[model samples]
Target: MVNFKGIGEIIKILNMNYSKKNYAIDVSGRGKATPPPLQHLLDPINKIVHSQRCATVTLPCILKAPLPKNYKVRWSKVEPAEYMEVVILITNGAHHKTYGPLGSRVRLRHSHRYDASLTISNVALEDEGRYRCQLINGLEDESLTLVLELDGVVFPYQTNYGRYKFNYFEAKQACQRQDSRLATYGQLYKAWTEGLDWCNAGWVMEGTVHYPIINSREPCGGRLLLPGVRSYGAKNKSKDRFDAFCFSSAVKGRVYFIRGHLNFKEAIQACQKDRATIAKVGQLYAAWKFSKLDHCDGGWLEDGSVRYPIITPRTGCGGLPDPGVRSFGFPSKLRKKYGVYCFSVK
Candidate 1:
């Protein structure tokens, strides 16, 4: 919900359910200005976020009239719906307080100038979500919405079924099985720009099959072909069989490689013994890309594949010149033995 005020201190009455279902509220006062409609204000907010790469996002929530000294700015987050019960009151400008699992520096200014804005510093992957910024006007409840996105790495995947075994839908399901989603074209291109190289063609989020060849060769594309992301365009969702390119977003928890080679089932038990769970493919990729996790041996990911991240490739470690998350495809879970990666929040 949004509140609109006309020029010269006009008051528009808003009647919405102002349920304080456990959230924090902050107050700000911005002096008189020719304010635009709530709808007009939202478009600019989206442009500001999407236009550039940002570590921190600044969002402004508008209020009618000179902000009341008692008027407040409120913030809350909800996800999975089942965890809705954990909504918390983070802060109220002056009387700052902490809430939720991941904590960042949230600041608010009630200056007598521009509209009230909230800033969260040192943003993390878990910070990506829908945040409600509401204005406290007694019965006339007004609010605005703020959305955050993550910046992370993407890796291509192949199920135990091997290359070209998946159609578009099966490719998507394969990524989900590995605790990942099908990579968007944008995500794949970003990975290409960040030095991701693979020879096998795979399915991405755009209902298309593609592959990146950093160094063209006879097996990859062609010996004379230049390096680039090759595309198979849009293929039939069910008929086409191909591998999958999966995307992993940054996560809040930590990932560790469990000592000793363990198969799929044993991997889960190993992590549980250490107060953790088997690390997903995404978690491992995030740890590799962001946390600089470098492992030489191919270990068991949550999807039961043997893989390793070689940030600095060398002999016997996948590629020699290229840095990537190398895969042994999806190996036999019960027959093959490999170390397992685990993840834990605490």
Candidate 2:
């Protein structure tokens, strides 16, 4: 049943190739960088690394060849939509230089002689994307691509215009305005696993519209249908309209509730008295998901809407069986009275 002899022979051949400097290994296993010739290559099947927000992650990139004395190892992030590459850092074994916002949080992990990996500290949601590690040696260059995925919570977003008013482009802009991005299918699935149930369909990534159904009532879909994420397939990006499912990661600041009977203007003043600003929708969701923030009183958010986080669902709190950030919609700026949620940026 075992083929140890064949496996050993293959390893031996690979080692011989490495010794001869005729091969190379890109972490993605998609093959070696061309033109300048490869020395020793080892391609791993799976290279994607999943990490949570604010957690440290190391993107592996080992070059097995006998590197030149003056070669440089550079790391850059590739934007998913535009394929725009931003250099994070560059090093030549001893001296290193960092660049851009990401550069301040990233450094090369030179643990071993062959290691040319990158270590990112305090990872943020904008850090999710493709990263490229390139080995440059004069006329020869070998590079590998690694994907960084963040584990976070997803929330349905809609404008004041009401439900299903945002087209694909508008939905993307709305999420961005809320300090979030359109959630990916995998991110939505993860949210569903953590008990996300919404009736309205929303735009996810890739021009796809999807919704999660936990209770499965008639208005949502049907009582008989099984509980899962429902999809409307790919829709017209310009014509079809839907809400947006935005994904937000852990926040550095803390969101707290300051109980008071205040309107929109007074609510802002209340937070200012406490030396903090009104919390945004994305910050509230991040606090609820990561810190388990629970409050019963409706609080005025920065967007003029009233909402509250409910980690433990109860009868008096919106009377809903699910645990989520309950919303009271956009209340009157002058008449409706509520508390305020303040965010302190430390």
Candidate number achieving the greatest lDDT relative to the actual structure: 2
Give the range of the ten consecutive residues with the poorest summed lDDT in model 2. Answer: 1-10
Best candidate, TM-score? 2
Number of clashing residue pairs, candidate 2: 7
RMSD of each: 10.4, 8.9
List clashing residue pairs in candidate 1: 24-89, 26-73
Superposed on all Cα atoms, model 2 deviates from the true structure by an RMSD in Å of 8.9
Worst 10 residues of 1 by lDDT: 7-16
What's the TM-score of each model vs. the native?
Answer: 0.61, 0.79
Tens digits of per-residue lDDT for model 2 on 23-121? Answer: 443322235533234453234456689887778999888877667768888888754334245778888888899999888998878898788889999
What TM value does model 1 have? 0.61
lDDT for model 1:
0.64
- Candidate 1 lDDT by residue in tens digits, 1-346: 2223332111211112324222332211112222323421232345223211125566555444544565555565533212231233433445645456533456654453434566666564445555656555565445555556556777777666556888888887877766567777877887887777889889876687899987789998788988889998988988988888887665677887876767778878889999988888878887887778888887777777777877787988975676767777777778546887888884
